[model samples]
Target: MLKLVVNNDLHVNKKDTITCKNSCDLFDEITGECSINQGVDIDSPYEAARCGFFIHRDSMSVPEIKDHTHFKFSLMDDIDDDLLDDQEIFHQLVGKSIYKEEYTYPLKPDFSSYRDDAKWFVSPCGSYGCWIVNHYKKPLSIPKSKDVAERGWNNRVYKSPIPLHDHQSALPISSKMAWLIDEDGFGQYALLVNGKISSISAPKPINWKRH
Candidate 1:
C-alpha cells in the first residue's frame, strides 16, 4: 500500500490526530480592496507565509518557474488582529521575488520518467514545503528532538539537495488524509484520515531507509 514516507519515530498511529488549515486561512483570497500580504497577530497559520502568500511559485504538480510576474516577495508586517473591520489594506506589505527561473533550483528530480501520480505524494504536506529524498540514514533531528529544534527551518533547505530517487512513483495515500509535523516541541507528526483517526487503514510506519 502506498503510504506517506515520514520519519520512523513520528507517533502517528490509530491513537494520533491531525489538523489542516485551509490555504485561505494562511491568507484569504485577496479581492480588489485587500492585498494578499495581510498578517494576523493572534497566532494564525498565515503569519509565517506573509506578503507572498497569495501567489505561488511551487505547486503540488510540476512547478511553473517562469510565471513570476508579481514577484510575491515578503515586505513588512501589517497587523490585522486589531483591524477586524478594515478590508482596504493588507495585514502586511510585500513584493515579488527578484530572481527568475534560472536562479531557482530544479523543482523536479534529475530523472527519466515521472509517475502519473507524482502530485498525490505532495498533497498531504503541500502547505509546509516538503522534499522527498532517496536516503536519510541519520535520524531526523528537527521534530525528533529539541537539540536541533532551533534548526527546524532547515527542513526544506537541508533535504532540498537530496532529490527523490523516484520522482514519479511517490508513495500515494488518499487526499482524505491530512498531515502535520510539530517541529517546535511536540516531537510528533500526525495524520488524520477522513477528518478523524478512525479512518486510518492499518496505519503503519513508512520505510525511509535508503535503497
Candidate 2:
C-alpha cells in the first residue's frame, strides 16, 4: 500500500490518525487544522508516484493544504529489485497503462500554428493521453477529454476500459520521450522533458468540479 515518512522519522499511517508537527493554529490559514492523526488523504497521482499505492477515491478522506512539509513515500512492491527497472510498476501502481503513437505529416507547412496538425496518442492508463506536433519539435496541447461530451472536441479522448494499440511514436530527441493523451484532452503526459517528468496543468479534482 502507501506509506508516508515525515522528516525521515514519524510514520503517518491511517489517514485519520495523521497529525501535524506543531498545532492547529500553525495551519489555520490553510484548509483545515493540522494535527497529528488529523486524517487527511493524499492525491492519487502523487500517492501512486511517490508510494506506489493505489488508493481509491472512495476510500480517501479530504486532503489538507500543508506547506514546508518534507515527506517520503514508498510503495510496498517497489522494494523489489526486478520491478525497479520496469516503468510498468509505477503504471500499475497508478492504474495507468503505457501509450505510444507515431505518424508522419508535411514538414514544409507551419503545422505548429494549427492544432489539427498534432498527432494524438492514448496513454496506457486510459484516464489521460497526449498529443505530439512533429513540426513543433514539442508535444501537442489539448484539454483533458475524459468525458464523452468533452471528447467531441479536437482533444484526444481516451477510450474507457483501455484499448489495445500497436501505435508507437518516435521522439527524434530522447529515448525516454513518450507522449500520453488521457481520456480527457485537457492534459498531456511525458517523461523528463528539460529535467521534468510531466507538464503541469490545472489540477483536476478527483471528480469533475471547478475548484
Best by lDDT: 2
User: Residue by residue across 65-101, what tens digits does model 1's lDDT show?
Assistant: 2221211212223434554243211211111112222
lDDT of 2 by residue, 1-211 (tens): 9998667645755353322322111122233422111233332223233321122323211122222112111223324556446564443323222333542322221112123434544455543334442322333443244454233222332322221222222222223223333423333223322122222122233444322
TM-score, predicted candidate 2 vs. hidden true structure:
0.19
Q: Candidate 1, residue 189: CA error in Å?
A: 14
Pick the TM-score winner: 2
